[model samples]
Target chain A: MSIFVDENTKVIVQGLTGGQGKFHGLRNRDYGTKIVGGVTPGKGGTDVDGIPVFNTVKEAVEATGATASFVSVPPKFAADAIMEAAAGGIKFIVCITEGIPAHDEAIVFNRLVEEFPGVRLLGPNCPGIISPGKCNIGITSGDIALAGGPVGIVSRSGTLTYQALHELSQQGIGQTTCVGIGGDPVPGTNFIDCLAAFEADPETKAVMMIGEIGGSEEERAAEWIKHNMTKPVVSYVAGVTAPPGRKMGHAGAIISGSKGTAQAKMDALREAGVHVCLNPTEAGQKMVEIVKAL
Target chain B: MDLFEYQGKQYFSRFGIAVSPGDVADTVEEAVAVAERVGYPVVVKAQVKVGGRGKAGGVKLADNIDEVRLHAGNILGLDIKGHVVHRLWIERSSDIAKEYYASFTLDRPNKMHLGMLSAQGGVEIEVVAEENPDAIAFLSIDPVRGLDLGTARRWVADAELDEVAREQTAELLVKLYDCYTTGDCDLAEINPLILTPDNKVHALDAKVTLDENASFRHPEWEEFRATETEDPREKMAKEKGLNYIGLDGTVGIIANGAGLAMSTLDVVNQVGGSAANFLDIGGGANADVMASALEVINSDPKVKVIFVNIFGGITRVDEVAKGVLEALKRVTISSPIVLRLDGTNAVEGRAILAPHLNEKLITEPTMLDAARRAVAFANA
Candidate 1:
């Protein structure tokens, strides 16, 4: 019933032998995600938490029938891992590695589009995606999210995603899925892509989108919402008071030449009939209100 | 990660792109020496990362040694749009028969490599794109396919570049694309890719932005880091592996993720308090990470109150609580800390902090409550 993942989705972890891979792989498995196997180039034939390991993603997919992959490799190898996942025919790839060079991402992204047209790459520096209760493929805590709710959440941040999920879950508002698209300048999926999916998902009654200052992605998403979206979407844009030309933690969370500012993003969203919240808690409350009215 | 004009020219030269031989100098004497070596008439250019250096008189053509000294003396230590120039690039000036523009940068929306080539070069490309849109030829290069000589030639012709400059320009464009990709640069731009009267094509000015994320792949980038004049706080945070940005405020804030860290800053302001800095401890909320973050925040004298906002997901609040307590023991903080613990193992986390609750160490039940308390303490 979620947008990208559900109960039927079988998962494989790339770089499963690495510390981060093993940690999150076990967590995802515990969250009821179908983590069938893993792929570690040199550490194939080993097992991580009873999960089988293979040398290549193709082998993992062949043996476990895995449809999705979690990329947990180091920054230098993350782009290649994504390419391998796509080449192996993984339908959905969620990369959790941060600090990947933009040029590497640019090459991998172009490859995914030209070669693996059907493959969906989530992030190179993101926390990944979570379909609550059914499957969890990212680093997002499964315990915080409620399953099969009327709300769908998409954000460009990690902890803020958790914050919104906590606020909603505290109010007994469950969600269908929550996606952290990552805060990289050239992330694999953007707000518009996630919003489009949310609009099509019948289970998603209302959507909550969290954005930060950077690029024109938010403004572009606002345009998409104005022209296309039918569901009520509540939103929040962080870094409202951020100083220009300074990067605020995230690589993409910067104001460049007055092009990407919180004020401009908020104005665009409001003009598109989207209720914008000032803070994370208020954003959750706005979503709750919209869902109740719906 | 932005390179100076001199460094950019050096990088371009590595890719076989023709650039006027240049050398950087810090003094008027050094500038004169460089001008003598390069054989004046030289261009005395201030080394600053910002644009409009030419308009600000940071760029001057010096025909003789006296002019070189005069220009370098003025350009060095000269403030151009708030960026003080501490170095100068002296190079042999080129004779420009025509000016063209070429650059390679990532197009985020399309997830592709964008290339802009225009016949109208000396002026800002933005002006060209806005005023005479068709004067610039825009091409989306497939990162995998890359730019070949044939495509470059067609692109040059499409931009309406002079017929004499086509072949060499196309060849140079391909090389520029190589430098853009192989050099691990976010942007490799030649604002004025000029054609001299002799039909020789060369880069007149170079602007490059290195991809900091790609530093691991290029070891030589250490040189770039050496030249960087980073803020002392930023340098210290980088050394400790903490994502920290120093700001001018009273409340010092630390959180586990970038989004939450930023939201913490926003909420702090929303509660009528300003944050002295933004620090993201990432997923590591252990004693070491917490202590390091605290040390960096403590170094900032403007901070009056510290806010520790930890919303655990995969990061356990109990672990963060223990880290906070352990960090408190390690560092003598000058300000009071307001801690907000929520999410996974929040109860256990709060229980761990129960014994440490005091006038200086306070824990709130919610983010809003925590922000309010921190702001109150900051103002008080």
Candidate 2:
């Protein structure tokens, strides 16, 4: 029922010996995700809490047949890790690493698109994706999510994405898949990719997209939804009170000139026939109403 | 990390891009000395990071040392768009034959390096893109392939640069592109890239925003810190590893993520209380991060109520609850704190803080209710 990941998906962790990688890697494994192997470059022939560790993604993939990779390397080497995963024949890569340079992301993104056509990347600074009751691939807490749902979620923000899940689950709503596209200027997956996936997934009855200030991503997604989406869509673009040129915590969540404002995004989404809310709580309530009707 | 005009010129020169001879000065005497060195007909430009400097009288043409002294003294204390001009860029001014524009920035939608070149420069590129779309030549260069001299020449021709200027402009564009990529700049811009009366090409003005993320690779970026806007609250928060933006408001906000932090600020404003700052503790709201956040917020005299809104996912609420308690123990908070904790381990989290619930340390189950209480406290 999930768009990208399910119970059948096998995952590998890059930089599994590192603190963040070990913490999230074991956590996801405990959540019933098939975290089969880990890669830590020279930490080969060892096991991190029962998950086999290999020296390279290529070796991890060859041994464990890991279809997806969870990247938790440092920012400087993040792009190289992603490319390594792509080269290792991993179809899906979820990079949880933050602070990757935009140029590096741009170069890697283009290369991935051109050379690794089969690979699907989630983030360079994202919370990663979760398929409720099936498999948890990234760092999102599994407890907040409910299994077997009529909704799919996509978000640009980390805590906001969790908030959406918590709100839905609080209202006794379950989700099919939740994607955090990351707030970086250059994200591997965008709103349109998630929206299109949700549209095609029969299990996903509705979509809740959470966007923030910065970049023309939300507006572009609204345009794509206007022409493409068939399912009911509810959205909340954060940072209405955000002033221009102020980097609002997130690297990508800043209003540049008159572009990427919360107001502009909301206006565009509303114009696209999506129910746009001023705040996240209202957006969740609106989604609940839409889901109840469905 | 927006570089001042002189700094931008220096950065451009690092990459072999031709910019006018310029030097930065903090005092009128220093400005006159730089003008003397750079020669007469110098531009005494205020080094504030804002637009409309000319309209604000921050930019003045000085033909002699006395004029430089007068203009520099007047411009130093000038306020342009809330930025006080504390420094001036004294440069030998070029006689402009034609003004053009060129820049390289990330194309968010296309996921490529976007090169914008316009025949019409010396104006906001957005204005040119809106009023005369055809006048601006947009080039989407793949980051892997990058911009080459051949493509830059073609791009300049497409932008319809003057025949005499195209060759030098193209070569300059290639150098600027290098400064953009290899030099680790977010934006390498030359507004009114001037074609000199002598048929030479050089950047008349520069607007460079260095990529902060790339700072790890460039230890040399520490030199750029001299021009940074000094906000003590922001400086402290940054030192403590917090993502913070100081605002002029009563409610000091702390959240787990940027989106949530911004929303918290908006909610505070909506509840009739303004936000004093936007602080994000990022993924993990551990004891250290929480303590630093509270310390920073407490240091702000304008903050009446510190609103910590945490919707924990990867960051467990129980851990956050413990962190908040630990932080409160470490930092003496002057303002009343209103905390809204939810999501993973929320029940246990609230239970963890059950003993400390009081008038000063308050907890609300939802964000709205907490915001209202915080705003009420701020108003009170």
Candidate 3:
């Protein structure tokens, strides 16, 4: 069983009328995702490539038995959309919008814990989780991802996952699922969360984790890997000796204090017994090498 | 997205917080005039988008016109922690009987609206907070309810504000909350919220940072675009809309993936060379985007060599190869480029890039070899 999405995950799309929602929804439908319906408020009667649209998430969930939702709403309204989806009883919600306000994100994060204690949030500015060969729930490019493997790929970047998968595929490596966890400072699911899923999956033999500059999340995850990861793990933390004060791509990719740096993360990973690759291309190769040795 | 003291205090004034009347000046002549208008004992504060200005000697108090000119002239041209002071804010200095501080900001990854209040205020609040974290009162404001008057009052008391300062402090707290919420600020800080001999509180300094995501709501930001003193590389990146940050390394990196770009830097150092910069072409790895990324990298004089690493998934390898070739044709390159193309349409991509192959545009099948070559070339 995959960690987030599976065969029984009946899905609904918020902002189905928007360009991204429609694109991913059509792809998901094509890939056999149980996209039961969509919600676009005023565009209720309209359908996104044959998926029925309702006025609100509550109505859509009640009518179609949708258990998961994909939110492609704008950043301004993303938090509201998540809350509405959670209140509507969507078990797993994936938000693909970028640049959400920090305060709005804080409110939503607090609400998720204080209000909807059971709902699982995939991302507010992240590529959604996917139970590969079963369901694809995020906006990560489908063409690059291939099903069937003992490897699981989790990353803080969307394009990096694609690149990693591409390199892995060239070496005849396939993954159970590849997750682009997004690079926003405030993300729904973190490395630790993804690691837990990869570790639990019997099909995943080893995990490839791609991290970048900013935040102590990678270091914390490295600490976790040192103690808990049952399967072999190959990792890469980006931005080695990067300029101290530059915003390195992601808003989350800033190195401020002593906690978040490539060296710090690399040290932690090394201490944890995880096979750390210094390069993106080597991440997949290292994963293969570890699996071969095992 | 960051506001200077004068601009932040303008917002503070809206919510009834007493702040010294001030004006921002871009020229030396205007700076002198503003200081004259504000009268003697004026505070010349640097107009930068960052904090710690006072510690950086960006803040100076002048009792006369000559001192004002000198301070404004020095502060205006100074670069404090990479943020250049383009303007000087001249304000009538306030008499301080006591100094107190308050600020609100997001706790980043924790995703909480964190508020900090302290009886000891000034430029040294950061150091004090670090050394004595519990000495300052911290509160997490609930998003739904927000920071109410009662919560602000409790925070003030916990921060050890004197009983005499509580009333004016509460009033200032409301203004701070308004600035934080209504202004869509990433940070709103008032240091040295001074208690005067008249028992009134005045904001001696205002620091506010706007949330970049919320720029859509404020159309007026278009008028305040100050790009002159921005890091040339950073400004160029801003223009192209590609996320770029210049580094001191020689290995110039161009990647479609942020994580990959970051990892490429690490790998460059691992193989014994520093990275020149972090450049991400985003999901759009087309020739145009690649060209922009290349242009940005080429603009950096420190970039002795280049690394073009693309794993084509959403971004086609063929497209990236074409982008590299197309960009190479447009710009004269002083540095060598190490290209590693893998993934979808890899055979075709390599073929397209094969003709453009030169001593500078070298291709490797593996990342390790490519990094080694790039780093070695950079050092050479």
Q: Backbone clashes in each candidate structure, one number apiece?
A: 0, 0, 4
- Candidate 2, residues B23-140: lDDT per residue as tens digits? 9899999998899888999999988778899999998999998899889989998889889999998899899889999999998889989999999998899989889999999999
Per-residue lDDT tens digits for candidate 1, residues A45-150, read: 9898799999999999889889999999899888889989988989999998999988888888877887888989898788888888899997999889988688
Assess the local accuracy of residue B365 in candidate 1 as a C-alpha lDDT between 0 and 100.
91
The parts of candidate 2 lying over 4 Å away from their true place are: none
- Tell me the lDDT of model 1 at B189: 95
Q: Each candidate's interface RMSD, rounded to one decimal?
A: 1.2, 0.9, 2.3
Per-residue error (Å), model 3, residue B54: 4.9
List the candidate 1 regions with Cα displacement exceeding 4 Å.
B55-57
CAPRI-style class, candidate 1 = medium
Q: Judged by lDDT against the true structure, how good is candidate 1?
A: 0.90
Weakest 10 consecutive residues of candidate 2 chain B by summed lDDT: B221-230
lDDT of 2 by residue, A6-62 (tens): 899999999999999999999999999999999998899999998899999989999
Please identify which of the two predictions, 1 or 2, would achieve the higher lDDT against the true structure: 2
Q: What DockQ number belongs to candidate 1?
A: 0.76
Candidate 3 wrong stretches, greater than 4 Å:
A143-146, A166-173, A219-232, A269-273, B49-57, B73-85, B329-334
Model 3 interface RMSD over true interface Cα atoms: 2.3
Candidate 3 at B158: error in angstroms? Answer: 1.2
